[model samples]
Target: MHRVIAKLAGLTLLMLSALPSRAEEARQFRLSVPAEVAESGLMDYLLPRFALKTSRRAELVGGGAADAVISADPQAGTAVMARAGTVYALRLTGENAAARRFADWLSSDVGQRTIAAFEPEQGAPFAAARQQQAGPAPALDGDPALGREVALRHCARCHRTHDDDRSSGIGSTPSFPALRALPDWADRFTAFYVLNPHPAFLRVEGISPPFDPTRPPAIIPVELTLEEAEALMAYAASVAPADLGAEIVHQ
Candidate 1:
């Protein structure tokens, strides 16, 4: 009777050890993006592709503009999330072990394949159509002049063109600091802005459009096309502050 009772207790301990705890089961994560990007009808196109690719290992939950869903459960592997613009941001979240596994998976061949599969059908392709509709192409003869012209035409309204002596004006200037930090920053910045000209950060900063509907109206219909954005980035790069090199160090 003693031997049988001891065996039964050992079995109970083994079963309990295999069971997951409550904390492990209730993990959650939140991700946010610009509302305009969500409303622009791109998230719908991107979400399913991301989910299908990731669902085998992770549970893809809520997704929309400004916020997304990802599970924190150890069993639910890592989740990847992104927000749009020339300077896009992406994040991954999960338990330590699962997150590490997901990171390895993302860096692997299978992960690359999954990312490659995400087709922004309505975003990039639509932008190309709009570009075609716009009349004769401006001669991009590897000249900063073309960049300046593009900038003056599209971006001058929101940003400063020339260098200002006043510190106050400089503080308010929305310059392309990133371009000046990188090698060939001019060409890369121009290309990026020309491809996507939307002021994603401006909206968040309450400088363009107030995202909250409850707040008093500020700006209306805050969005921009890739071409318009590209023009702005290119122009900013052309006239970026000389001290941009120092900013990169801090970054």
Candidate 2:
């Protein structure tokens, strides 16, 4: 029994010693994205969130030195059934632990949802590692009128809430009607607040429409409960054009 315990302790020490010894490398996590995709603003939104969730300091690398690389399935075009996206862990230097944690998180429900929510201008929803049918839609219990009121009060400053009520929102932000026009808008709305960019930019005290440059920036995204999100979806749907065309998913 004593011999077995001694052997186990030696084995443990051997494994620890085998691990990479660069303290700086262990503290830094690096991810590489395809160049075209990197330019779409999606990775800008996602990579920071990845670091935040996994408690790591992540850096984006050009192509190599990546703890993980985000790539499309090579057989996607040729194979009838191919993965939507694949994450490759390079096990570079001393980043194995950080790499594994980020990869695991990417496959989690929250991570997959966030990944799918980012509709990059250059591509479609990401092929998540764990692909599952979306869960049942959240109940829309709040009043549509109340939802519109909420939008006018909170979202109008940044998003175009109505066709007539334009020229008020941030120039770059999408109009609510435009967003609802998408075929999968319903699903997208379900996870919007929990996804990147939204998580970073939304504030509880929604800035008023017509930019006031003088006010100090507010923290916390325009606060909307699940109930409010449901109502907002309903209101946006009501205003959306009946014949809005299908949007193409970028490859």
Candidate 3:
């Protein structure tokens, strides 16, 4: 067990030495791969590219003490990626930031393209599993009326709730309509409580942990029940998106 850890650590240092520029800031994690993958030199081919793009490094290791794993079948943890049929895919064991970034890159179009491009001396390149057509997401469950009330009491201080709500909310911050216009509006609304500015002063009862006493909120805390937070999302979803036209090209 100690020998395996030492081997991975030594390899990590060697890899870091090759990239002196990012070595200091690099986040290193272990990724356990099947023997086939290791023998194929996929990590040797993929890791350098991933590290160059993300500045995070993975030290290839065997089973145990790994932050992530490459598997043909995942029994647990987040399934990151896999190829069609015979051996494929990387899986995460936890919410490691570096691991997530690696997963993101692996799932990205570039990542898929890179995977398809890799050709071992003796075998065919791995291909992505065929994805099924996804249907529209269901509308979030909550009371829009109550959500509006919550928004007016809390969010309205920073965001314009309606087109006519110019008198309220800070000018620098975006309006609800404008935010709803964004591509990731749903993600933004649903996870806003964890996003910046909100975390400092906002709390969702039974969901968010209590604020640290040593670093108390800058302003009087604004607390909400989980129901209120869900309702706020419902209201935001109901808002009409502002018309943000085509991108301006600088030719």
Strongest candidate by TM-score: 3
Compared with the true structure, what per-residue lDDT tens digits does model 1 show for residues 30-134?
344345445545445544444465442333334452123232221232323222212222335434433344445444555544443444433331111111111
> Residue 5 lDDT in model 1?
100
- Which of the predicted structures, 1 or 3, would earn the higher lDDT when compared with the native? 3
Model 2, span 1-251: residue lDDT tens: 99999999999999999988766465567777666557767667766887776656667885557766665433221111011222222223333677667666666667666765676664334434232222223444557897898789887878888888856799888787777766656545554543334434442222112222453336434666556767876776677654556767899
User: Which 10 residues in a row give candidate 1 its minimum summed lDDT?
Assistant: 125-134
| Ranking of predictions according to lDDT | 3, 2, 1
Question: Clashes in candidate 1: how many?
Answer: 12
Clashing pairs in model 3, backbone N/Cα/C closer than 3 A: 81-89
State every prediction's TM-score relative to the real structure: 0.31, 0.43, 0.51
The Cα error of candidate 1 at residue 197, in Å, is: 11
Q: Model 2: how far is 152 from its true place, Å?
A: 0.4
Q: Judged by lDDT relative to the true structure, which candidate is superior, 1 or 2?
A: 2
Top candidate when judged by lDDT against the true structure: 3
Off by over 4 Å in 2: 1-137, 201-221, 242-251
Q: Which is the better candidate, 2 or 3, if ranked by TM-score?
A: 3
